[model samples]
Target: MPRTDTASRVITAPLDRVWDALVDPAALAVWLPPAGMTGRFERFDARPGGSYRLVLTYADASGAPGKATADSDIVEARFVDIVPGVRVVQAVDFVSDDPANAGTMTMTWQVTAVAAGTRVDIVATDVPDGITAEDHAEGLASSLANLAAHTER
Candidate 1:
């Protein structure tokens, strides 16, 4: 069975700024991690049928210095729906090198504009067997915080 996890956060920034930070590679690298972590996008295409790949490096939760990795090279991302500055729905699939979990998964990012800022919701389904929902939740929260900071600045 495929497990699903959802995470959300509200940022005090304009919708356009939030959207730009989400799609731009350079801007994404700046706000995609916690204080001690950093990320870089290898390939990113904002439109549908495009591919997206990013590398995230961070110290373990125990404060130990180590590299954490996540890759999605075979992603067939498509913009399912868009409402200009209001909202966006995207479908993402993961490609893994491990033979044990070679299947693809789908993730949806839903953004809503609010009076104070923007509300972002991410629902990822079909997570591989070894990955835990709690860990993914923590990571998504950290990334959203970083994103909020980046957009505010």
Candidate 2:
């Protein structure tokens, strides 16, 4: 069965800034941490049919080095729906070298402005069977926290 993971965080930043950080390669590289991880965007169209690819490198918690890279060579992402600074729905897929995980996944990122800050919600489906949901959740939350710090600075 496919697993789903969701995580959310409130960033002390404006929606526009958050949105920029989400799409900008340089900005994304600043955040999204597994510690010592960097992201390289091959192609980011941001619109429907646009493609995106990112590389992440970091050390495992046990002090071992590892990488979690993904390439959406032909993204089917689209602005299926939008609410200005409120929310956005896009289709996301990941292509990995691992044979166990070679398929498309749909991911949606929702942003909502609150009195304290902007609440960013991320939902990912079709996670590989071997990977645990909790691990994905923690990774996403960690990334979000890193993003919050990056934007706050």
Candidate 3:
């Protein structure tokens, strides 16, 4: 069986603003990587059947160069479902030579208006065996944190 993970966070921004940030390609480059990393989007099309690609690189805690061996991860994804200001679902697969990580995963992002702000829920399914549940959860939460900070600014 494939692994599955779910995480949610509340961004201090309005639903519409968050939605725009999430769907925009340039905006995604600003806040998509997890802690201690940076991201660059090569292509991003936010409509159903459209696709996107991104590169994420790792750095040290001191923000200095060196130390980490696994320098980057490449992700290619497709937008499967998109509901303006409401939800975005995607199918993802990593570009890797390792057979252990070979597989496609589906992630659903739900955005809803809340009293405090906008609630963002993430659900990922069919995760490859190489990715642990805990690690994937942290990555998801970290991404939400990044989004919150970006939208709040």
Candidate 4:
């Protein structure tokens, strides 16, 4: 069965700023990768029906092997929906030879104005079985923290 994982954070920034950080490719390259990893986008088209290819490389090569390469995880994602300042939805897949990791995951990012700042929520559904629950949770938390740090500045 597929799994779902979620993470959320409140950023000390306005809704627009937070939303910008989410859609801008440069900002995403800076904040999307989890701890111990760094990401770069080969192609990015931020619009509904558009797509992107991102490569995330592990800082320590000796760590667990990546899904696509020895040190990198390549992700192909399509923009399913984009609601400026409100939400962004994506269909994502990893480039991997392992059958357990072959699946499309839906990622939804929602932002709302709150008392102190903007609240960002991330929901990832249909997660592949190859990604363990604990690891996914940690990665999601790490990415959320990164986004908060990047946007709150």
Best by TM-score: 4
lDDT of 4 by residue, 1-153 (tens): 999999888888999988998899999999999999999999999999999999999998686789999999999999999999899999999999998889999999999999999998989999999999999999999998999888887
In model 3, the runs with Cα more than 4 Å from the true position are 60-69
Which one wins on lDDT?
Answer: 4
In model 3, the Cα lDDT at residue 73 comes to: 74
- The candidate with the higher TM-score, 2 or 4, is 4
Question: After superposing candidate 2, which stretches have Cα over 4 Å from the reference?
Answer: 60-84, 88-90
Residue 95 in candidate 3, Cα distance off native in Å: 0.4
Mind giving the per-residue lDDT tens digits that candidate 3 earns over 1-153? 688899999888999999998898888888888887888988888899999988888765344221122577788899999999889999999887776677999999999999999999999999987777887888888999999988986
lDDT of 1 by residue, 14-74 (tens): 8889988776778877886545566666777766555666655554435432322232223
lDDT of each: 0.66, 0.63, 0.85, 0.94
Residue pairs with colliding backbones in model 4 are none
TM-score, every prediction? 0.75, 0.76, 0.90, 0.98
Ranking by lDDT: 4, 3, 1, 2
Instruction: Tell me the deviation in Å of residue 74 in model 1.
Output: 10
Which consecutive 10 residues in model 4 have the weakest lDDT in total? 60-69
lDDT of 2 by residue, 40-127 (tens): 5655555545555655554332443232333112222344444555565655444445554555556677787788778899887886
